[model samples]
Target chain A: MKIKTLNLALAASMAWGTAASAQTEIEWWHAFTGRLGELLAAQVEKFNESQSDYRVVASHKGNYSEALNAGIAAFRAGEQPHLLQVFEVGTATMMSATGAVKPVYEVMEESGLEFDPEAYIPAVTGYYTNSDGQMLSFPYNSSTQVLYVNRDKLEEAGIDPDVDLSIWENWDEVLTQLKDAGVTCPYTTSWQSWVHLESFSAYHDVPFATNANGFEGLDTELVFNGDIQVKHIDQLGEWAQEGKFIYNGRRNEAGANFRAGDCALFTESSAGYAGVKAEADFDFDIRHLPYWDAVDAAPQNTIIGGASVWIMEGHTDEEYTAVAAFLNFLSSPEVQAQWHQDTGYLPITNAAGKLTEEQGFYDENPGTEIAGLQMTRNEPTDNSKGLRLGGFDQIRTIIDEELEGVWSGQKSAQVALDSAVERGNQLLRRFEQANR
Target chain B: MEKRVIFKGWMLPALLLMPQIVITAIFFFYPAGQAIWQSMFVPDPFGLKTQFVGLGNFEYLLNDPYYRASFLTTAIFSTLVTVVSMGVALYLAILADRLIKGSGTYRTLLIWPYAVAPAVAGVLWMFMFNTRVGVVSWYLGLLGYDWNHVLNEAEAMGLVVAASSWGRISYNFLFFLAGLQAIPRSVIEAAAIDGAKFWTRFRTIVWPLLSPVTFFLMVVNVVYAFFETFGVIHTITSGGPQQATTILVYKVYSDGFVGQDLGSSAAQSVILLFVVGVLTVIQFKFIERRVHY
Candidate 1:
């Protein structure tokens, strides 16, 4: 009797498996690794299991830049996935690739799915939308810059670990104190261009580029070397000379130093919490990114630095339906809330943020809500909506090179920023020509 | 004396050469032709539209000071990598040639680095001299030396050069060792009988005999340093410390692959191809005649 029951169950499972195999498969290539990558895979698995008609298969295609390149290469060769995750820097490039990407608005409208653009957080969604208020991509895993404080290191320097270092002036003072206490690395940062120039401009409500920071026109030029930007970098240059601030590299290399408790203070992406939480053995806290109190709209807001998922062009109608389903599944409040809480990325949808709050996640996690709150704190001005310059990835490298000169005492901040602006504008022009 | 094999029919010869011709066309000429074509126009990332701007990319690169600066950096980098790698390999090959006991182990160890990938070798060398975590930097710090390659231009250049040359030494070592062993022991023995010391024999006879191998390795190493060492530069310095280590090939990769500026990158590749072609021609024309063989 037991053998007969086992045979019957096996037959039933085989029948179900055959039925499942008939599901339309949707392919998604993303740029996530470690904890986030695992969460992304689990979400796909859940989505697939939750439905019987469509199966979304998620694959890690290297980091942000690599995935974007892969997506383009695939599209050129007619092998692109149904959806792709492109980092914020690639927004202009992807947007200009008019024949390659299917705008999210069209995808929703075509699939007859309910998608209110207003339902998503404006600060995050605004970056991927056009001037006509049409959403082009799904803003996924959005993160803003935050200050990571190694409390134990600060306390050892005879400074109160929680003494409200929310102003740049106060933070500057604490840096000196930490350095005086023989701290090797008093302060450091990852993504120098992002933390300094990009988010810095947004935080002060200054233009990083002309043409309303590239939202208004393709002929936009970079003007990040403004007086405010120069002054801030000059201050950082002075700090570097005084052995207060350390620049490890252009990317997130300094995150390792901070996570290892070598740096007392670090300015990095709020997404850095995932790594810091796992790797740090010291007492650490995530706090608001410091602002210069002198600026007119002081502490206006910060820009997001993560990636968005874009639907590609050229697919069967049935495949489009499957992609639309998976996208809706992704933006569903429960799934997005789980993603936001697990990865420390800002909740994309207002409903998800509300759900997370109602679940008491923010109250329980302490400081985990800082990223979402920082983004939503202010009504985003034209300057703070986020830069949409073409060839921004290359421009960031130019900024990095110039900033390296400042940090190394090779060039004054004025000269360096000037040079960066000049060089970056050339790239912007090239982007303009190509995109036009 | 040519010892050339003669084929019986034209059909056989054509068939034999067909595979190589096809491969060269597919792998080398096709991509090069595409680069030259792409270099003449600015294409949108989507491949939907391309704007013809003949020689525009080249004009921009030529005018760009950073791209111009990369030429000098490439020159300095390739020179250092070639000299240091060749010099160390020659010294080790000489030592191994003289060794009788444990010579196999010594030679094997010398050639081991050749097996390591360029990126892996870069990481290994970078790990040892890294400012934050490297043991060497730590020791240097203990000695009152602040070793910061990230901010220091000279240190960044030095780090990339060392990392690039470290793996290349094994390849040079193998060639040098083989060349040394191919020289008959009788000749060196005869020289020693004439009261010639090691230095005298090496300078007068062994050096002349090793000239052919040296010439071949120099050409190959120069080419390797120029095109291949970008991996080391990318892994260690990433062409920074304010473009102090921005070698030409690395810039090509940064602009084309990472930045997705196809026209600029393609122009850069075309220039690189021309450079390597000129270098190889210069070596064959001027330096090859000096080889004793």
Candidate 2:
């Protein structure tokens, strides 16, 4: 009996020995492809090589919407990954998933990791925090909207390549000049609702929806049909009629038109820089997103539009510790600076920005700092802080549909905006009922 | 005279039917039953909380104007797809039937498109008619005719229908060709001997004999248009340019999956199921009357 007991103890120790040698594996499902995806993989590899305690495996599930859907379905099937990268639009949906996700604060605290929520930039962190002012998710790749100017196209049109397009008035004149210069596609935009309405409202210090743009409560109502939004859209409708502004598809599909040198101006995400840099053979510059001169607080601040990493529940405490360590490694100043400089995403921490500046990276890249400066130019107002609403993706679709009506000359801007608000309110009500 | 099979032992027949019943119950009835059950309750995103709201989802959907508009869109979309695909397929099949040589080559070339997925077909069509950088659109622009489906409702609807029908024509052609080849040549010769031209012969004899195949293809095509062509619509137009192409199935998918509104999505599914059921029954009772067989 004594010999048998000793043998069993020896067997248990040997099993643990093999386990200790093999690092813990933490599955991370993200929604980035191309350059961003490669950068993410590199970050994971560096983290893995720097430590022997854990191995972080990063997988590209699909695009933003697909990845979020995969995570939700996986969680329901009791096989969710350790971490999920959810896009900015899905923030509200992720926040309301109660027990399905472990808050970042809780994860860090439980893992006994040294985490300071204040170390992150407020504008980036505020979007992913709870009502109690605790960070819920780790902001990874955040970007704000910016205007991309094809300088070569501008010069070809006989307009100044350094034209000031910071305001709608200046853009209107530039567009008219470009149109008269035989430019068929003078100006086009990607993410019409994002650049034209959502960020536009925030940049002009106007409420996109009530309840602080749905950040305060679930009972938020659609209020984007106010005078400011109507005027801006009305002006765009006139431009559409004049062949100055072209209406592309709902998503970032117009990036192709701009990158191919077929369009002179493009309002797209800051992260679009990578594609433009890679594809365009012409000179291009990044400009601040234009604002309306009629508004009292024009160009207040632009909000972010990118994904954040969330820790999924149903993992061991040991795995949670690994996740914390991995996120910490990702959030380090050197890593964040490299990611920001390479990807054109905003550095999530001020320390990273300072580090990048100290390294003279921004000075070398010229226009690379516009996105961060635009995001932090002024303190964010109630309207400027990022929108947090359920059914936001659907609402954006409705806005796209209604705006298409205006572009096609089927309905006036007022009528289209009014109809969109009515339709969007119904969706919001449905979402509120379900979540409440 | 109608032929009937008589079973001597009930056990043998029951056992034979058992597989089909089990398959249907497992594959169809089980998930459908769950959808119906879920339609009555609204669940939060996490499924952590749910509220029983019997008949509320249905009532809301009925009152919603966009849902009603989508009903009309689906009706128009399905009709166009069915007619366009079947009409083109019948024409091609007749042409192939007339050809003496290279008929096999033509049929094989026509059958190649059916292998492409619906989403892939959509992308192919979208590229041809894309607003910018499209070969066809550029030619059209050169001809002083602009084609922008991104903002044009009619163009958006036309693009999706063309794509959906383009992929489906191959399936319809296969059936129509088989049906056309099965028609006895002696009958056509006899009709020709009766002083009938090609159009007259086709109208009187060919169409009548092809009714059974036509009826089967009609039902199959309608079901395909209702359920399967969502990938085409989703990829090309996304039911967009002001919901002009927002068919019933796409709405159900967008609402349930993208919006995460499980109750509304389930309700839409139940309504779609009822629509397909009623449509099938109506086609049999109404359309099958003209079938001579």
Candidate 3:
């Protein structure tokens, strides 16, 4: 009888251990670090605290490229996380992974979560949404490129700190003012291809490529070597020669240059606000990107930077339910509003924006609304909507090379642009053929 | 019966090797075979649908100007970096060998860079060579050099090679130092009796004895320059100033991950493998025979 009781106790303990170990754990891989990483962790903690059925574990894989590569490698190894954060440029590649990804709208519908695509701000949602108006991915930490002004530098240069830089709609006027103020490093930009080429084409209402920048189809050719692009690049080349615009190395290396008060004006992403806010010892403000006022419809919306959350496939129904729950928690107004206010990323959903406005955050923080205002200023044309080109990141590298040639006087702007177009078209053709 | 039992005894050793054989099959051989397989095909970035086109990728790569440039660039970069680093490392190794006191301290200091991770090394070099805030750039400005890598291709390549050599010299120094220490005191004492000066002694006895170490370092350094500096190039230049620094491995990374042309990238990898394989085989056949020890 005593032996039977001991066996019962042992079996009961084993059963309890199994029950404890069976709490559906979901892995979320992201690319955020520092402040944004902390916020993400807090969000995950809140979600985990709200529920006892599932536990969400978020891991900082690496930077954006590293994280994306890790996710791809993990997927190939059949150990993919339930959620993956991919940058905006990786949208096409993520979309192509049909078997490897679970579309967010489908996940929401399958899990019976209260998901409304329209609840997301159209300007932000459209980037990650399909043509049929379905949310393919969850828009997280979306930002548009904007002009950052070092007010103290402007004031030091004897230029009016409040001098309506917003009205100087063209590069010519901006350059003139910068030159007049003796702003030697007045006009420097980050992500030169993104700011000068991608956003330039959009702001000028020109097609960066055919087939609606490959949103419609993959067989798109490079069309950015047009007259406007040439003229703009030539002018920038002239500025580079004059030492007014310096071409720092690629990828936000110039952010430090601008933040250190070495450069008066900077063309960088709205998300740069976080770093600049933390590091810059001087007062600074964000403004709408300057446009070529000569164009018919100048100052159209800018395209998005930052990244979105992608739901991977090959998980159980229970995991999908957990993903849906986590995503819903992420999209909640309170969570999103706090995230936007903290990170300088655009609030992805309309409810979040409304909630932020109700709290008068915009009134207190000037120019925080500029990015949203500029992106949604007009109904997005086929040209204005974000690029969906395959092999875009590589093409951007090519464009960067050509633009560097222009800056360095190795090639004329026209010659460089022509060569870049030709070279880039070959890639597009290859991409088209492969995809077909 | 005895012979049969001896043959059966070999089965134990064979069984012991099973795990390693399986691991190599799964990890190394499988990936290499897959790369060779994938090189013959074109893959869709989105669906990753691969279609075999047998030697098409190789043919295209041979014809592609960018690939050709990358090959030439890789060869030149590898050669320059290996030679320069070997020269500097040999000089430092000899200098440290002469030090009777604090030789260990000097050796430790020299080998410190080898202990740093490649990514950290890249970042460290970036800070030194950065255009705006780099100490090197700052000093160059004081010296009235252009110092702007954005505009100057020669300067950019020089900077990359210099940085690569700086990071690599430590490893070579360590090897050369060990080889220098192992050189017999009798050989050097005999040379001293002949009244050989420093350069004379170095050129005659020391250099010939160090040739074997030099040859080994050359092979390893070439491979390091080809593969290891890709991160530095990506971080520092992104193969910029008109594709001046786009070496083979950088192109492979850009093509595979950034370009999402996995087939073409794999094709490039196979080409790199071929080149490195040929070089390695040539080294073993010709160069290895020349090493004294």
Candidate 4:
């Protein structure tokens, strides 16, 4: 009798739940937290309120790496969500997982929605596009490496706050000045591999890997240990020994030191604006990532570093329609402009970039447009387009390990980067073998 | 003579053991078999294609310098964790056992740290040792010593071992306290009357008598350090500073889940399983003889 009543109650609840909403529910597993999470949630809420056809339920699924792993596990279990937010490093993995994901271009075509590939920023979209000229994922939150400086720290160190920090020659002098002024941590950085290696190679117009960074084929080799890259790291190693630059962890753990007003300068993602604005009390400014002035073709455009939204497989046709509609909504000029202005992420669409400019955002905020200017300043060569090597996440770890050896004075920069290239190439070959 | 109560029929005994047998088969044997099967093949991330390469993953792991170095790292890490945690717990247990008053409060206080999860303990220790903002490191900085575990291999290994051993000390403390309490007061008093000082009595009588518990804890703690301490390592060092702290279990996690190299991870797990099997066998066959119950 008790079991019968329990079943009756459960049946009633199920009926009531279905009766409550006729709208189709779309699940989006994202890797956003804190303020960015709130904004993403607001976007979903606004989309849901704007139309009654679909209710997008966006949930935070830890950080980028964790969210991708969750998606993989869920897909293996045949319970994947409708959409997943994957970091740029996982782009190759997701693209190779042909059975686990539905391409965004296909989803757009099937939804009968007004979708145009030309609308997205070229440098941002190029990273996720296949050789066949099809976009694999929706470029949701694109960011480029940017230098963040504490203006107060600069002034306190008796340096001109208006000095040009765009070039590495000037930046090195500034680092030395700050150190000479008794600054303990004159400079620090976050995402060392991303900023120093990937973005550095792009900004200098050097290939980070062969096969145009794996766009041509999967059989690519890591060639980031070239002369320019080695010289850059060797200089950074010298700076470390001289107390001009401080070595932080592999990831963004040094963001804390920068925000806590301990470091004078930081090289981090442009998306670091949100955290700087929220947690920092000192005056800070975002600038273009520095380039070595010795190189002839310096100051080439930097690549994107943020995540994209992937449509996972095993969802219904109706859900795919909703996903396409939501992606369109997210890329709308107004929404994209708002996201760019709010989070310091790049406006994935050219229209959104124009929209942000027309609203007088750059004029009002001095450093807000640096990321945009840096990315769009030059036509991206094959070298500056960005990398798409498989197992890049592990390769980055290997690079981090090698770089740590250099920073600790245990190994020379050349030797360390050579080993990194060798290790990374092994991973690349293994990836090529498996994916084939 | 021991009293034996036999079941009337084989059906009764079999029925009683069915639940355990079924659970073991489902949880343990099934996963072990799957891991072994998967180790022989490399699959793409989506499981779209699979390439069979029997023992190829193991061969690669053996040839890879990093994987071989990880074996040494794991040996060093487990030995340090077990020895440090057990030694500290035994010392504390002996101290707490000698106190005639407020022994309950002492034991309770000692065991409370066990309630904290390994991950939480790792985070706690990481915060305290953070180079930039950590209080302990800041104090160390004031003393003219730089504590940079991010680039310092020895420091990184030390920090992780300390964090991994922190919560385990509580568990070992609980067992040691119980074993000390279970010892008869008359034996200890008789030792003391025989002109044996506290140290001598503890060395001769208490230490030998406590061998059974010590032996049990050594095996348990070794296993814990091998498998369960991945949480601490994952939270603390993340097998960093040039793979200085990459234990075998941590490597397995990073390779499989983070790197998405399933076949290699499976091969690593099989090797880890064999190692633990050998350890358990050696402990039971040889060490058990020395342990008096």
DockQ of each: 0.70, 0.70, 0.57, 0.75
Cα deviation at B171, candidate 4, in Å, is 1.1
Question: lDDT per residue, candidate 1, A64-145, as tens digits?
Answer: 9889999999999888999999999999998888889999999888987777778899999988889887899999889999
Runs of candidate 3 exceeding 4 Å displacement: A1-25, A167-182, B1-28, B44-48, B187-192, B284-293
TM of each candidate vs. truth: 0.96, 0.96, 0.90, 0.96
What is the overall TM-score of model 3 with all chains considered together?
0.90
Query: Can you write out model 4's per-residue Cα lDDT over A100-216, one digit (the tens) per residue?
Result: 889999999999999999998888898889877799998899999888989999999999987798787787789889998988889888988999999899889999999998888
Expressed as tens digits, the lDDT of each residue in B1-293 for candidate 4 is 99999889799899999999999999999999999999998888777888999999999889899999998999999999999999999999999988989988988888888999999998999999999878999999999999999988999999999998888899999899889989999999998898999999988889889999999999999999999999888888889988999999998998898888888899999999999999999999999998888
Candidate 2 local Cα displacement, residue A228, angstroms: 1.0
Query: Residue B162 in model 1: shift from native, Å?
Result: 1.2
Candidate 1 falls in which docking quality class?
A: medium
- Residue A78 in candidate 4, Cα distance off native in Å: 2.3
Candidate 3 per-residue lDDT over residues A111-165, each given as its tens digit: 9978877778887878788888799999888988899999988787677777776
Docking quality tier of candidate 2? medium
Q: Mind giving the per-residue lDDT tens digits that candidate 3 earns over B218-262?
A: 889888987888877877777877789999999989888887788
* Alpha-carbon shift of residue A236 in model 3 (angstroms): 1.3
**lDDT of model 3 at residue A331?**
91
For model 3, give the RMSD to the true fold: 5.2
Q: What is the lDDT of residue A332 in candidate 3?
A: 92
True lDDT of residue A386, candidate 2: 84
Question: For each of the candidates, what fraction of the native contacts does it recover?
Answer: 0.68, 0.72, 0.63, 0.70
Interface RMSD of 4: 1.1
